[model samples]
Target: MIKRKKIYIEALRILAIFLVLFQHVPAFDYYLQDTSHVMGHLFFTLIAKINVPLFLMISGSLLLNREEGYREIFRKRMIKIILAILIFNFLVYLAENQFVFDLQDYCLGVFENGIDRSYWYLYSYLGFLVMMPLLHRIAQKMTKNDFILILFIHFVFSTIEPLLQWFVPTYLGQSFEFTWAFRIPFSTIKEIFYPLMGYYIDRKIHIESIHKKTLAGLGCLSLLGILISMFFTIWIGNQEGFSDEYLELFDYVSALSAFILIKSFFVHYEAVIPAWISQKIVLLGSVTYGVYLWDPFFRKLFFDGFDQFMIPWVGGFFSSVLWCICSFLVCGILVQFLKRIPKVKSLF
Candidate 1:
């Protein structure tokens, strides 16, 4: 039987891809030191920060409640994921070779370093898949209070500790061994935290009964979180001669809140949608993984290609928007082509 799709998951996937694109806006990186473009940097950073968490949450919502055995999960779910990672890593090696000319070095680097930093999500997710059986085992045994308490600890370590470490040296004059202890836990917890939260919410919370104002309130808080992120970025950038990387732990609050709001929004509104638009939306959503894998390549292409045409005419912000749209269209078309290939379709 063909299983019915959840509207919210579809919506979340589409949202995540766009946010990922926003994060990659070339101007954000190139113009980070430009005071005039601070607003642009902050806007993109806020949306980009949410992309990975929301993507993981969507995966958790879809996969955590499944009845399949470990072997089946590996065979059915993870095989494709692993394949995609390998394929994309090879693609990245080829892309990077254009400048370095060292085929041997690039081959070794692909396994050690990411094909691109964006591919970090793929490896993180692969690890998450391996750990899911154990995670679900723990989740199944936990009481509501236990779940909340664990999440509290995760937040403290993942978000709070990192934020504190950034400012702690200025006050304390040096880093401590205890800081590393806290930091080490985040390396383990970071990948699974948002997904586990999504799973818990999907398996436990009832989103339909929640007041709509709750969602609205969370949406507002998300906006506030972005503004706070902006100020913090500027403040920290100035602190170290505009050389320090902008810190954005504040994204956790808004990312989690936005996930809940999006979930609730779809649950309440999805039922009234027309079939035509719904199918179209779901179709677009289906190609997101491919879009993510190919986007970096096309981003480089269009960003460079449009430099002469769009950048000169429209400026950086609008040129970036055009680049993003063109990348999306190209990726969508490419993914659809990949889907038709018998053996390769499964990788996407």
Candidate 2:
């Protein structure tokens, strides 16, 4: 296993995240909503898609070798996520000033109701947290033959999941009625297999011999995946033309595949960029979670009346980026403060 902390890997994580962030920029819809040309930022979806699964894959590779038992693993993983959910949801309630009725409604359907909006990611990730230990053990057991079987298990589950939800109908994701984030019980259980395959692949595949060539191959696959997904997204948008609700599901899957390919490229690459720019990117990327959470508020703060501001596109764009950075910094400070709070220290 690659034991040392690779700064480039960390950089890839942050970069993938920002692709998600920039893709969320409202200006893309503003510019490309009805045009022949797609916004550059729209490609962010293709790039950003890999962000989460890559994260999980990385987690699997890094954590599977740990010596901790199941109970210790569970405590280590779940406590912080569960606490984060509780604290963040409680804060959301306070901001909204209404009772969550013991999180009954929020748990039942946050996406559908749009009650506590940001908690969807929290719920889905928490679901992952709960299942990690079992997944790790499974990874340790599989032989060469078992690899294909494990992958088959993942493929079958992924294929049937969406169909079953629409036709047979069951509780697909977290208990939240609003959005499953598509991580249902079966899929969540099935999720155990992918990380192992990722871990398996990483361990068996030596990039040192053909780092440059493999990186090229991964880059091509990543490109192919993104182009196909972008076509699907753009096609649906133009013809079937956007089911804001359902299309996002396609987008998410596409993003995941692309992310994995990109991750492989970085992992296999020997030549990294300059330390100064890499460091800056990593720093910005470090604040990405906070940035994702707070970007909307920052947009509201700075860009609410951007067009009316007497300045040109340069001013407006800078304002948007600047406000995003400011928001990340502010949230970073808040996260730091939260870490200091005795009761809340564990949540981070």
Candidate 3:
């Protein structure tokens, strides 16, 4: 029997993709340099930074619950992503290189650096797919406390330590080597935490048991945390030449909280959403991968042609929102068209 798509999940996917598009807006650099709108840029960019975390959480929520074997995973999941990467990368390469076909240059670009840096997620996701079976097994066996413990460990090594290293004065710190001191090497496991956290929340948490007031308070705090982090990021960037270490760390924390809050809100009120709207959300969500692959092309096309005209009047933030909306719509339509072609459909 075929399963029904959860509207809340689709909503999350839509939000994630829009955030991805918004974050990639070319005007960010312009805003960053503009004294008048730097804070606004920082605020929006911080929110946009949640895109990857949200996507990973969605993946975790959907994939961890399944019991697919290695063969099934490779055939059903990995192959498609691999093909998408190759095909889209080549398309991007051709576009960037003016349709020049150089096998040697193309191969070097593919191996040394991606032809399109936006496709980094596809390669990372391919790695995630390779490890999904093992991850699923661990996730299935994990108790709530085990999940929490892993999250805590990741938080310490990944978030807390990094922040401390950045803020602490170098003169006051001493390096001491201990043979028995062991660390989980969170640098490698950082990306793994989001999916695991997603599975934990989706499968283990009973949202109904929690009070609405409590959830609201947590959500408010999460928003505040995101804002505070953005402010600090701006301040530090101005003072210390703009390293994203602190902001990126806080992003993981904030994104997790935001994901939970958004998921809870959708779960509680999803039924009230009009059926027509939900259908559109699902349709848009379904085409997100394709849209994502094609977004940069449209983004450049639109931004280059229209940004100068719009920015001076409506300002940077609003102009970016407008561009993002247009880019998403165009990319969505393009993806739908491509999906109809038998030879190209598999890439999406």
Candidate 4:
């Protein structure tokens, strides 16, 4: 029997896609450069950085529980990703080239420079899928203590070290360098950690058992930590010229905490969500991948159009939000439509 859809997971998926759309909204970029609404834009951008990790975590939560063999994973998961890259990259190439298809240019774009910058996650995800079998094995064999140890190592290296490197010089007025001898590549660590945490949370921990007050406190603290880190990073950058170092919010402690808190909230209170709303969430969640692929194209369109008809009062964050909402709905609808077509459904 087909397993029933998890409403909370679907809710998180929808939220992730929305965050993705919000992050790519050009208004954030405009305001960041303008520096008038820097904090507001930066705050939202940092929060949105959780989008990719949340997606990865959700993947782990769903995928690690399965006992699918390598053949099934290849046939079902890997093939679809490969097809999406080929087909969507081609579409992106066509759009970029004004529908004048050039095989040479397309090949170069795919093999050399990426066709679209936004689809970087797809490539990363393809890598993750390649390693999923090993991840699954580890997930199956590992105890809770093992999972916790791995997460701790990831937290120390991925999150804590960076925070210290950023925080120490600015606040403490001292040089601090802490390097690990057995350094794992960050991309590999990220691919492993987020999903592993997701599996751990989903399988080992019971969200419903956690008190609501505790979760609330964590959520608040996480948000505060994220804002403070971002504020200081931006402030220091202004003082010492901008660097992408700690300002890159993904895999940060606060962001991960926020992700877990949000996940917990959804999972814990999932029963109270209205059935109608739950259904809607599932439907939208189903199309998030397609929406993600299609969003950048529409993002460009809406960004340009919004700029052309720019309203003075709504020029900043509000306009960016409007652009994201419009793009999300349009892309979601487009994806839903595409899903109905026989030839193109699978690729989408």
- Which candidate leads in lDDT? 3
Question: Candidate 2 vs. truth: CA RMSD?
Answer: 7.5
lDDT of 3 by residue, 181-298 (tens): 6576322364577788888787888765768887878777667767767666777778876545555656666677776676677677767767787778778888888888887655
- Once fitted onto the true fold, the runs of candidate 2 whose alpha carbons sit more than 4 angstroms away are 1-4, 20-32, 39-41, 96-114, 143-190, 244-326, 333-345
Candidate 1's clash total is 0
* Model 3 pairs whose backbones collide: none
Best of the candidates, TM-score? 3
Task: Write down the worst ten-residue block by lDDT for model 2.
Answer: 243-252
Q: Encode model 1's per-residue lDDT on 157-273: one tens digit a residue.
A: 655666677667868888743345344332236567777777777778888787878878878877886776667667777665553243455566677787778777667666676
Show model 1 residue runs off by greater than 4 Å: 1-5, 98-103, 166-178, 183-188, 243-246, 300-302
Error of 4 at 133 (Å): 1.0
Q: Given candidate 2, what's the lDDT at residue 38?
A: 58
The Cα error of candidate 4 at residue 29, in Å, is 3.7
lDDT of 3: 0.74
- lDDT score, candidate 4, position 257: 68
Give candidate 4's whole-model lDDT: 0.73
Question: In model 3, what is the error at residue 22, expressed in angstroms?
Answer: 2.0
For all predicted structures, in order, the TM-scores are: 0.87, 0.66, 0.89, 0.88
The C-alpha lDDT values of all candidates are: 0.71, 0.52, 0.74, 0.73
lDDT for position 210 in model 4: 78
Range of the 10 consecutive residues with the lowest summed lDDT in candidate 4: 1-10
Superposed Cα deviation of residue 141, candidate 2 (Å): 2.4
